[model samples]
Target chain A: MRIWDPSIETLDRVSLRQLQLTRLRETIDRAYHHVPCYRSKFDELGLGPGDFRNLEDLRRFPFTTKEDLRLNYPYGMFAVPMKEVVRIHSSSGTTGKPTVVGYTKKDLESWAQLVSRFMTAAGVTDEDIVHIAFGYGLFTGAFGLHYGAERIGASVIPMSSGNTDKQIMIMQDYRSSALVCTPSYALTIADRMEKTGIDPATLALKVGLFGAEPWSEEMRRELETRLGIVATDNYGLSEIMGPGVAGDCLERCGMHIAEDHFIAEIIDPETLESLPFGEWGELVLTTISKEALPMIRYRTRDITRLHPEPCRCGRTHVRMEKTRGRSDDMLIIKGVNVFPTQVEEILFQAEGCEPHYQLIVDRQDNVDSLTVEVEVNDQIFFDEMKLQRIFIQQLEKKLATGLGVGVRVKLVEPSSIPRFEGKATRVIDRRSR
Target chain B: MKVEQISIFIENKSGRLAEVSRVLGEAKVNIRALSLADTSDFGILRLIVDRTDEARKVLQAHNFTVNKTEVVAVEVPDRPAGLAEILQILDDVQINVEYMYAFVERCSGNAVIIFRFDNVDEAIAALLGRGVNVLKGEQVYEL
Candidate 1:
C-alpha cells in the first residue's frame, strides 16, 4: 500500500508531454506491427511510427468512438493474445450495445496505481475503510475502485450498489471512512438516512468519490451539505481504463487529470477540431499505458473544459471542470435541446415536486410534446383541492424557469414511479410515426 | 365457470386511456365490461372483451403494460332476490369479493355479474354447486 501526495504525484507540463511522446512512439510501433486493426488503419492513412514523434502528430490517427467499439464487438480490437488478458469490464449498455474493455495483468496494476493515486489525492489513507457502492460485474465502477482500494491498503467493504439500508448499516457498523458511488446514490443514501432517523454527520464517512454520471455544482453543494463530508468528483470511462483517470483534491475546484498515463484533449464535438484552454468542448482521451486494448483520440462525448493553470494544491497535472453535460444525452423537446440535469436541478429547487421524475416524449399530430411526470411527496394531498392547484402551479413555474420552455408537469404520488438502482432511465422517446 | 379478463397498467395521463381504446377499437375487439382500479399516479384498466387475444395484441402493440387473468362471471335473473341468492352462496363459502361489476346479458332477461374474488375457483364452484347459473368463457364472449 503506497500513496502519492499531491506535491510528488508526477510530471510537469514539459516532462509530461515528453513522457507521452515516448509512450506514443512505442505504442504506435507495437500496434502497427501486432494489431491488425491498427496496422490496416495506419497503412490506409500512410502513417508510420516516425510520424508520431510528438503530440501534434498523434492527431494523424483516427478518433475512436463508442460506436467503433461496438462495431468491433467482443474481441476485435484486442492488441494482445487472449492468454495475456486477465480482466474485463463493460459499460451499462442502456443506450445500445455494451462496450467491452479488457486488461492484462500489467494493465490491471497500472489501473490500480492510477486509481490509488486518485484516492490518495482525495486524502484516503491506509487506515481508512472504503465502502464501494458502485455496481460490480461487467461494470468498471466497482472492480476498478476495489483493486485501487486494495492497492491503497484500505479495508474494502464492496457494498456494490443498491440496498441503501444495508449500505448505511455497514457504514455505521463498520465505521467506514470513505464512500464511493454515483452522486445520485449518495443523495439517496442521505435521504434514506433522514427517513431512518440517522444523522449523516454522525456517520464515520469522511470523504466521498462520486462519478459515473454527469452531475452539477448545485448537486455537489446539496450532497455535501446533506452528508456532511468532503465530496470529490472522479472521472473515467471503461473505454480508457475505469474510475482512475482523474480526481479532485481538497480544493474542489476541478478534477486533476492523470496526464502521465493518458493524454487529454478537448475538441469541438461537431467540428472534431481542438479547442483552446478554458473553452468548452467535447473531451477526448488516449490511453498510453493500456495493453489489452489501447484507444487513440477516443471521443468521450462529455461536454467540459480543460484548465491548464496549476492548482493551489500543488498537483501539476492539468485540471478539468466537472462535466457540464453530455452531447449525446441531450433530449430535444419540441425545438429546444433539454438536458435531464437541468430538470433535476429545477426539481431539487422547486417546492412542489419530489426528486423522482420521468420525462415522456411522444409525437402528437407530427409535433413532439414533452410531458414531465413529477412525483409529489405528502406535501400535496390528492384529496385537498387547494393543495393540488398550488402544487401544479408551483411545478409549472419552476420547470419553465429552469428549462426555458413551457412544460406540462403531472403530479403523481411518491413511490408511484419506477426507481432505478443504476443509471436512471429519465427520458422515454416514443416518436414512431 | 371460467372468464377471461385483461388488466393493463397505465400511467395516469391525458389520452392514455383514449390511446388504449383506439388500439382495441381498431382491432374490432368489443369490450364487454370494463373498470379502472386507480391510484393517484397509475391505474389498472380491467376489461372483459369479445376477443381477448386480439385485444391484448393491440394493447401490447401500442406499448400498453397489459396482463391477463382468470375471473368468474355469474348469471342472475333480472328480478329481486337474484343477486341476494348469489351473495348468500358466496358468504356461506366465505369467499370475499375484491371487486364486482355487472353487464346485462343481451336478448336474455338476466344480468351477467363479473366477480373478481380472492379465490375465483372456489367462488365459481360454490355458485355452480348451489344451482346458480355461471357463465362460461364462450357465454361471456357472446354477451
Candidate 2:
C-alpha cells in the first residue's frame, strides 16, 4: 500500500530531469570510454560524451539495435570489466548469435530496486508469498522477479516453469499470494485448474504480474476472472533491464515506466524521430542509470505510445500503452517471441522444403497456436503418405525447437501457395483481437 | 502409354470453379474428364483436357498453380464388375492407387477411368501385360 521509493518515484519533472541529466552524463561517459563499439560509433559521428547537453540530445546519436548487440556477441557491449560484472542473460536471436546483457554488482542492485518498486506498485506486500513461474537459466524474467521479490522481504517460490499439475498443487499447499509469469502461462495454469475442477476462489492468490510478451486487454479480463486476482501487465525487454523496466500500479491503466532510471521515447519507426505524446509509434529506450552495459537510445521495435498525464495512483513516471502489436515481424505465440524471418531461416536451411512458406497464427480455446504451411518439393509430395507425415512431423519439431514454441506444419504441393507480386505476404494472423 | 492430366490448385471459394471453367473455355480447351479433390482451405481441380499443354499454359498465365501429371486411361465396360475387375487386378498386384476419376465419351457404353498410381511405370507395364487396353496420350486427347 506504499510506494517503494516515494522521493524518486513521485519526484517532479524538474528534479527528475536534473537527476536523469546527471545519470545520462555518467552513462554516456562510461560507454564512450570503456565500450569499443560505442566509442567507434561516437567517433564516426564526430561526437563524444561531452557533447551530450540535454534530453533532446539523444536524437542526435545513432540508435543502438538488436543487430549491434548481436554483433558484439557475448560481452562487447559491457562497459565494466568481467571481474565487476555479476551476471549475464541472453535473448533468443534469429541468427545463431544471441543478444547478451551484463550486469555489474551495482547494476544488479539498481535493477532489483527498480523491479521491487514495480512489484510494490502492483500491490504485492512484504507479507505475501510470491510464486515466480518464469523460466530460469538463460532468460531474465524468472531471476529478475525472483530477486526483486526477495529484496522486498517477501518469501519467494522459485518454481521455474512447466509441470502444470505441480504448479496447481503448490498454489494450494504453499498458499501462494502473488503469481508472476507470462499472461499466457497464467491462462494455461487456469486451464489446468479448470480441467481438475479446482475452484480459483479456494486459492490465496490476490495479485498477478504478467509480462515478457504482448497480451490483450481481453486476455487480462479473462485472467483476472479465471484466477480471481487483479492481473496487471508489466513491460520490459532483455536489452533494458528485463521485466522491471515498467509495470502497472494497480490502476489497470497503462504501465508506468521507471522514468528516473530509463528515459523512454516513442518514435515513428520509419522516420526514427520522436512522435508527439499519445500517438502510437515504436518504443525506444535509453538506460541512463545502467552502468555495466549502458544502452543509449536502443530501438525496442515495440509499438506503443507514452501517456505523461498524472495518473490516479499519484506516480509521476510516464505510462505506456500495453503493447499488443510490434513494429517488426515479431509474433508472440504463447508468450514466446518469434519472427517470420526466423521461420524462413529455419525452413530455408532444412532439406526437402521449398523456400516458400506461410505462417498462420490463430488462437483456439484461448491458447495461441502457430500453423506453418510450407511447400514441399516434388520428390516428397510423391512419397508415401507415411513418409510425408514423418517429414512434416520432423519439420514441425525442428521449427518448434528453434522457435521455442509448439508448431503445426502442413505440407502443400509446390507452387500451391499464392505468390505476391511485390512484398510477399508471409504471415497471416487469424487471431481475433 | 501414358495420358497427361492438368491439375490446378484452387482456393475453396464460391467462384473459383467458375473462374477455372471460364479460363479454359476462353482458351477453347475442351474438357474430356474432370474431378475435384478438396480440403477445408483449398481444392485441386483435376482435368483431362483435349489440349493438355494449352490448358496448363493458360492456367499458369492466369496465376494459377498448374501441374501436368501422368495417369492411365483404361476402358471399363458398362457392366457391373467392369470397374471392379480392373481395381481387383491392381489390388492383387499391390499397385496402390493414389487417386482416380472416370468419364465416358459420346454416350459410349465404355467408360475411361483415369488412374494416378504411385508406381506409374510398373502399373502401366502390369496392366499392358495382363491384356488390358490402355489408351495412349493422343488417343485420349483426340477422343
Candidate 3:
C-alpha cells in the first residue's frame, strides 16, 4: 500500500509520456555528441537527434547489443569525461571481455533513489534491518542493494556472500528484517538451517527480495515455507542501472517497471520486430535518464511479458512478469527449447528432490543427451539397494514426463554440487565441445 | 539374530574404495565381514566392523554417505550342501533373502554367513525353528 515518490510513480500516463519525450531527446543528443559509437550508429542511419518527433521514432535507431559494448571495451560507451565519472562497475566477462560502465555523482544519487523506490515497495521501512548477502566487487548486485537500503535509512549488514553458518548466526544475532540475495542462495541458507537443526520460526526474518537469477514459483513457495518469510522477485541487469530497474509491490503480482527512468519494449528475438502487450519476447530497454551510459534501445535478451493494466497497490506503472529465462541461457535439446527454470519447477514439485541440481548436456554419436545430477540427502537416501533403484526409476520417469524429453538422473552425495555465492550456474552444455 | 552393519554409498571411481578403507583403517576399526554391491555408476560397500558406530562415524566424517542396517548372521555347517540346506528352510517358510555373503572367520567350527533378508525377524525365526544356529550382534562383531 506504500509508494515511494508518488509524484513520479503515480504520475498520469499523459504527463509521464511527456516527461519521457523530453528526456529521450536530451539522451540522444548526449550520446550522439559525446560517444563515438553512438555517433557512428546515428551516421549510418542518416538520422540526427532533431529527427525524433515522438516515442515511436525510437524503433528507427539501431539496437545496441552486449557484443557492441564488448567491442567498445572500457570507457568507449561513456558519454562523459573520466573526472565526471565517480565510480565504475563491470560484468564478469566470462564469455569474452567484460563490458565496463561508469556512473557520475548525480548518477549514483539517482541510482540510490531508483533502488529505494523498489525497496520501499517490497515493504522495507526505516525500522527494518537489511542483511545483504551479495558479493561486493566489480559486480553491481551488492552495492546496488546496499545504497538502496541505506537510502531507506535502515540498518545494513554488508555480509558479502559465503560462510553460510556465519550468515545464519548473524541473521539471528542482528535480527535482520530484510534479506537481499539471489533466490538460489536463499535456498542454500534454508538447506544449512535444516542440517544444523535451526528452526526458521525462531528467526526474525520478515521479507526477502531475491534477484540476479531466474527462479520458479514453486521455489518461492519453498523459500516462504522453509524460511518463514515472504519472498518477492525483482528484475534488473548490470547493463542497465543494476537492482532497481523494477520490483514487486505487496500485491505479489508482476514487477512494476520504473518507466519514469527507463523505457521498456518487447520484440521478437529472431525477427527483431515489436510485439503486442501481454506477449512473451525479448526485452529492449533505453536509458532515457542516464547521464554517463546513454544506451539506445539496448537489447536485454531477457524473455518476459508486460501487463499494462493498473495494479491493486495503486501504482500505474506497467508491470513485467518474471522472466522465464535469458535468451542466451535457454538450452536446445533434440530441437526443443528448454529453460533451466522449467526443470526447477518440476524438481520442486517432487517430494524428496532437493533444490540443488545441475544439468549436464553432452553429445554422443551425434545425439544430444541431458543428465541431471541431483544431490542425495538423508530424506532421499535409502539403505536398501532395491528401493534406491526404484526411487531413481520413478524420478527419471517424472523428469522425462515434465521435460518432454528423456533424461538420465544421477544422484550424488549432499553438498557435492558447488554452491554459488552470487548468481548460480545450473547448466553445463558440452555439445559445442 | 539381527546384527548391526554399515552401508556406505560410494562412486565407482578409482581411489574411492581405498579412501574409505584408509579412513576406517586410520580410525583403528577392524572389518569383520564386508560385501560390495556395485552398478556401473556407484557402489554400496556394506561392512560388519568390530566397532560399527566408530566405522560409520569415521566414514561419514570423511564425507561418505553412510547408513546403518540390521542383518541376520547364521552359522552354516561346513559341508558342501550346508548353505543350500539353510536357504531351503528360508524358502520353505516363504522368507526371501535379499543378499547373502560369507564371513571371514568361522563360528564354533561352522562357516559364518551374513544374510540380509526382506523380513529380517521372520528369517531369523524360520532359521531358529529349523534348529539352525543364529549369531547375535556381539558374537558376530567379536568373531
Candidate 4:
C-alpha cells in the first residue's frame, strides 16, 4: 500500500489558505524583485506584496498569458539565474512559437514529490511497474512521470510513444502494473491489444494515469472497459510545472489539486472576477514553490470547476473537474460548441475508416459549413457509384447524430491526409470574421 | 500485347466521379476505357488511359492515391456470342472472373473485354490456350 503525506497533501481548508497566503507573499516578492516583467506589471498596477494578504487578493496580480511568456522569451521570466536552472520543457507550438519552461534542482524534486503524490492517490506503489508511454523530449510528460515513479521506487519502463508492438511486448514481458499516457493513445493500445488476442485484464496493468488532453466520462468508461484497469485523470501543464499539479484518487471523482505547491482559482474569463465554487469558469494557477519561474495567477485558459469537498481517499486537496476545452481552441460550428476530440470520438466509432482525419470549417452565404475528410482504410472497397453515395450519406447522418450538426463527409484514399506524431491538428477554421 | 490501367479507390458520393474526371481532364490525361467496381460504401475506379504513366503520375502528384494493376484484356468479335464464348472458356477452367467490363476495340467490328480474375496469370493462360487473343501491356497501351 502507498502512503500519502496528509499534513502537506491533505491540509484542512483553513491551514491550506494560510499556507497559500504565506507562499503567495513570498512568491510575489521574489517575482517582483527578480522578474522584470512581473516588476513592470506591479508598477503598472501600482501595487506591492502587502496588497495580497490572502488567496482572495490574488486577483490584484496581473494575469500572465502565453503571449507574455513569448514576449519575455527564453529565461526572461526566471526568478533565479541560469546556473540554478536544471531541467527545461516546452509545449508544442502548433499555432505559433513554443512556450518554454525551466526548473531548478529543488523544483525537480518538488515536481517529483507532487507526481509521486498523484501516483499514490491512484494507489500506485513501489511494487507497480509503470509503463510510461508519454513522448519524451522537451515535453514535460515523460520525464515528469519517470522522475515521479523513481521517487516512489517503482520500476518504470520508459516506453516513449509509437512502436506499439514493442510497448505491448514489454508490458507483457515486464508485467507492468500501471500505465501513463494520453487517453487517446491508451485507447489505441487497447485496440491493438484486442487485435493481438491479448486480454487487457490479463495484462499486469491495474491503473492508468491519462492526461495532457481533455476527455469525457464516456471516454473514461470506454478506456476502463477496454483496458480492464482503473483509469484516472492526471492534470498539469508545462506552464504550471508539469504533471503533478493534481490527479484523481481511488474514488475517481475529480482530480485533487495539490494546494500545497500551487494555488488554483476559478475566475470568470470575461470579467476576470473570481467565481463561487462549483461554477463553470476559467482556471487560474500560481506556482508557490517554484524557484526558476514562480508564476502568479497564470491564466491556464482551461474551463473547469473546483470542488473543495473532502475526497473519500482522505486527501484534503481541492479537486477540479476534467478540463472541458481550451477557451481559445473551442469551435463554434453552426451555433454549437464542437471540440476536435468530439469529432475524433465519432470518427473512432465510424466503420471502415482510419482514425486519420481533418475537419475543414468554411463559411459561405453567412452559414457555417463543416467538411470532414476521413481516410478510407485499404481493406474496405466498394462498387464505385453505389459506394460513393452510400458512404457520403452514412457519414453525414452519423455526423448529424454524433455532433448534432450536419456535415459534409469526404472519403479520401489512405495516406492522402496528413498525420501528426505529436499533437494532432484536426480543426481548420477558415471562416472569415 | 500490353494494356495501360489505373486503379483508384473512391468513396461513394455525389460529384466524386466528376471530380476524378475533372482532375484527369485538368491534367490533360485522356481515359481510353473505364470501369467501376463498388461495394456498399466505396468503389474502385479502374481506367485504361491514353497515357497510363502520365495519368498515374498526375493523379498521384495531386494527392490522389492510385494503384497499377495487371488486367487481362481479350479481343472478342462484336457479336452476341462473343462474350458468351469467353465466359464458357473461363468457367471450364474454374477461373473466377471477379469483374469484367467492355472497352472499345481499336480494330473495327470487334470489342475488347477487360477481365480481372482471382489469378491473373492463370486466367491469361486459360484464355490464350483456348485461342483467345490476349492483349499484352504494350499492345493495350498502343491501342
Q: Which parts of model 3 have CA positions greater than 4 angstroms off?
A: A330-433, B1-143
Ranking by TM-score: 2, 1, 4, 3
lDDT of 2 by residue, A184-264 (tens): 789889999999999999999999999887888998899999899999889888889888999999886899899888989
Report the interface RMSD that candidate 2 achieves against the true structure, in angstroms: 4.8
lDDT (CA) for every model shown? Answer: 0.79, 0.85, 0.85, 0.81
Highest-scoring model, DockQ: 3
At residue A94, candidate 3 shows an lDDT of 25
C-alpha positional error of residue A10 in candidate 4 after TM-score superposition, expressed in Å: 2.3
lDDT of 2: 0.85
Which is the better candidate, 2 or 3, if ranked by DockQ?
3
Residues A1-433, candidate 4, lDDT per residue (tens digit)?
Answer: 3446777775788988898889888999999999999999999999887787557778777898877888887779999989999888876332234578999999999999999999998889989999999878777889999999999989999999778889999999999999998776787788788888998877899999988766789878988888889999999988889899989888888998989899898999988898988999999999999999898889888899999888777788888998886766556554344556667766766663447788998866334688888776533334334445676687788776666557888777767577778877778878643
* Residue-level error in angstroms, candidate 4, position A316: 1.1
For every candidate, what share of the true interface contacts is present? 0.03, 0.00, 0.14, 0.29
Quote the positional error of residue A38 for candidate 4 in Å: 1.1
Lowest lDDT block of 10, candidate 1 chain A? A378-387
Model 2 TM-score, all chains together: 0.79
Off by over 4 Å in 1: A1-10, A94-96, A330-433, B1-76, B79-101, B104-109, B112-143
Candidate 1 vs 2: which has more lDDT: 2
Question: Of the candidates shown, which would achieve the greatest TM-score relative to the real structure?
Answer: 2
